[model samples]
Structure formats: C-alpha cells, structure tokens
Target: MLKSQRLIRMIMIINARKSFTVQEMADEFGLSTRTVTRDLLELSELGVPIYSIQGRGGGYRLLQERLLPPIAFTESEAVAMFIACRSLRHLSALPFDEGAESALHKFYHYLPEDSKTRIDRLKDKVAIWSPHRQVLPDCLRTLMQSIMVRSVVAIEYRSTHGVELRNIQPVGLYESDGYWYCPAYCFLREDYRVFRADRILAASLNESIDCREDVEQRTLWDLPQERAPLIPMSLELSPGGVHALRSDQWFGESIRVRDDGGGTVTVDIPSDKIPFYSDMIWRLGEDARIVAPEEAVEYVRRKIEAMRLRYS
Candidate 1:
C-alpha cells in the first residue's frame, strides 16, 4: 500500500487497539519493524498523542484524549454543519459552550476560500433565531453530568417562592423560549418536575439519596405521559389572537381556524400547567377569551383583580 494509505490505516488500528507494540503494527501491515517505528514517529509528529512505555508489559498507547481519524465531507454537508453551529450562537450559554466555539472556529478556518465567502454571504440571509436571554445557568455542566450517570443531585433552586434545596434525578434537559429546562424526578415533591436551569443556583452530587430505578429509563420525550390527569381547556380567539398564537410552540397545534379568520384553541393539559396557560391567555387581553375550565378563568380573574388593587 502507499505510505499515506498505510499511515491512515495504522492510525485507525492504533485507535482501536489503544495500546500496542511497534511489532504489532509491523505484523499487521507486513512491514519491517524499523519502517513501522519510523511511521509511528511520523504519526506522533502529526499530533497523534502516541507515547512509549519504558517498563515491562508496557506498550505504546494513546493518551486519554486520542486523535480522531480524518473525515471527508461534501461541500453541502460542511455547509450544513457550519450553519448548525452558527444557529446556536444566539444562546447565552451552552453546555458545551467552549467546545462549540472552538469547533466552529476551527471548521471555518480550514474551509476553502470560496466556501468561506459563500458562508459569509449566507450569514446575512439565513438565521435560526432564539430569544436572547441574559440569565446564565452556571450549573448546567454539573446537571448534565448527573443526567449521564443517572445520579441524584442536591440543588439550590431559586424559584419565585424562594430558594429551596432539593434532591433530584435528572431525566433530561431541553431548551424552549430562550431558557433551559431540566425535567427531573424530585425527591422533595416525589414527582416529576421541570426546573428552569437558570434558577438552579448550585448543584452537586447527593450520595445520601439513591436514584429511582423507575426513572432511569425516563427522558424529556416521556414527560407528557408522566403528567397528572389532563383537564380540558378551551379559548375563543379573535383574528388578531389567532395570528398572535400561530407561532406559539405549545398552543399553536391546538388552534382550529374558522372561515372568519378567527380560531379556537381546545386541548387537554395537565392541571399543574393551568397557571402557566392562564398567564399566557391573560396576556392576550381582549383578543383571547377563556371559554371553559373555570379554574383557569378564576386564576386570570384573580390576577387581574390583584393587578387592579396593586395599581389602585
């Protein structure tokens, strides 16, 4: 085989074996040990992270951070990846913030000049907008680590009520409306709850609490199934309200438009979500009228009255 082909194949083999003697590479490639040693030296110079072991029973092994084999990507595929990373630039914080930035920089730096020009032109035309929220969740990495190991974490959460400490087994995390949410099995509530990541003041492993075996298989997608009993709710929407809510991720699908350009949102949501839905509908003012579910109506009325009294 050509030297370049041999070197690439050797890199793959070394990555898989992780620890091997020079003789192993020579035997695998049917080459002389001298040639294999020279190739290994060349690989090391190319940042392959190869290190020799001087003692008995020790062989050359890659460092903990092994180099990845080169990958070939089509122009379209490369552009897609660049755009995907570009889209995430709006978020205030990311679990892999530094890694993402570095990767994007490296990827862009090596692209052909023409491709770079194309990307620059498209930057003005294409965008995936996410709301720019200022709140940063410093504990995002800790929370992510807990999810990976399925471990219980004790967290100091600052909610509207007050700061409270709770032990939780995180299911998964999701981003919506410019905020990160961690859905977890809360030991305090003994139920599944969604906590805003920004509200998490601190998080650390809690060895005192055992993670629930039942929730080990749970994920963010399974949250709807884990909800309390659903309660039917309906809203009558004017034309303006229909237009305003058409973009709502949560309620957009529930709206049914009429010939008059008006619409109605009718859906069953868990009772625990009533307060959130009420606040959303209340913000629509006259454009939206709550049609059913006296609970939500009452909540909105109480809010309106409270605001009135506060202003008075």
Candidate 2:
C-alpha cells in the first residue's frame, strides 16, 4: 500500500481503539514495527494528539475525544487522488485553485513516511506539460460566480467571424483539450450554445432577471442542434489509417478498437464533416477503404481522381 494511504488508514485504525501497540499497527498495515513507530512520530508532529507508553506493554494511542471522522480508502483511490492533484497543480487556471491546493496539502501531509519519500521521488518522474499553453481566461472567475448565482452575463467575445457582444445565462464550464468552454443560454440566439472562455474579452453579471428557474438542466449532448444533421458513417482503415487514428486522435471517441489490431470506427458525423473526412483520407496517402454511405465513398474517389489528374 502507498504510505500516504497507509497513514490515512493508520489514523482510522488508531482512532477506532483506545490504544494500539506498534506490533498491532504493523500487523494491520503490513508494515514493520520501526516503520509504524516512524509513522506515529510523524502523526505526532502533525498534531494527531497521540500518547505513547514506555517500557514493557508500551504502545501508542490517541487522546480522549481526539478521534477525527474516519476516512477509508483503497490503495488505488489514494494514488488516483494524488496523481489528479498533481496534474491540477500545473493548470494555469482552475475555478477552485485555492481549494485544490489546500486539499493537495492535506493529502500529502498525512501520508506515511515512506509514501512521502515515494512522492518526492515521483515528483521528478511525473510532469504535466502543455505544448500550446494558453493564458488562462480572465473572465473565468467572473463566469463561475455568475453561474453560481444563475445570473445573466454579458461578454465581449471574439470569434473567427468577428467580435460581438453576447448576453448569456451562465450554465457551466468544461475543459476540452486544455481549453475551457462555457455552455450557456445565448440570449441573442434564444438557445443554448458553447462559448470559448479564452475568446471572452470581457464579462459582467446581470442581476435583473433570474433565468435559472426556466433553464432546464441539460447534458452536453442536449445542447442546441447544429445546422448540419448527424449521419451514420463507418470506415475500414489500413495499417497506416490505424496509425493515423492512434496518433492524430481524429474522431477518436467514436472509434472502437477490434482484437485484430484493426478496429471498427462508426460514428454519427455532422453532414458538413463528410467532405472534411474525405479530404483527410486522401491526405493520409494510405489505403483506407470507405465502407459506408456510398456518398462518402464516391466523394473520396472523386477527390483522389482530381489529385491524380493534377499530378499527371
């Protein structure tokens, strides 16, 4: 077990009883007596209110009414939490940055002595690197605040088309590929839409109307539909196509890997993306046979012929 996790369990073990011998704790956690003694000492340093008896029959126990609420966890849970906190610590912007830091500190400080040592060693081993790191959106905090109060917010947003003012009911925020997006009820469009946080030039909450009561809770899929209808599509990839799928991560979530190295990838692509996928397959210069919606197959063939004639 990870020392950090063991430390948490140790607290629970000791708190469950009036007193425990080093042998008892060692037996429970599968650690050596010396290790248990070191853990108790570290717990003492952290103000766990432990008292130790001396000489024969000596053991450690917590003070009366000093028992904290039990927090039980499996080894995997502890490691997962540790890794998650480690990743979040590197994020430039988080809605709960301070809370995340405090929680991480508590997680580390209560770790078993060996686990602490392991974490120190692992710190250099693990890292979160963003190749195209974005400057955290300045409006993120304000947008979060607005969402909590269910207030309408006005934002000066810049998109590929142009800059415009948007009055939206702040709903929620999510991170995708390291960028944050806010799903909001766009007042201008009279529907829900997702806005990129980084594109929000400015934002301010509107206190006049409470739009929360009327806005139904909806998942990402429930968001307003796009102009292009979704269509069933499937593809048969060659070795290179499989490599492209793995490396490029294009339409990855829709892919299902098969046992024989090749996989079945079927998804409902937006009608507009059919042409895009055709162009992508042609660019791969690999043998990927289209297997569906005869339209896509014909589209790709024409593009290939066009390229062939251009080269010829």
Runs in model 2 deviating more than 4 A are: 1-76, 90-92, 127-131, 232-260, 272-312
How do the residues 68-116 of candidate 1 rate in per-residue lDDT, one tens digit apiece? 7778777899889988888888888776537677777878888899989
Which pairs clash (backbone N, Cα, C closer than 3 Å) in model 2?
3-112
- The C-alpha TM-scores of every prediction are 0.82, 0.58
- For model 1, what is the alpha-carbon lDDT of residue 67? 71
What TM value does model 1 have?
Answer: 0.82
**Predicted structure with the largest TM-score when compared to the true one:** 1
Candidate lDDT (C-alpha), each? 0.85, 0.74
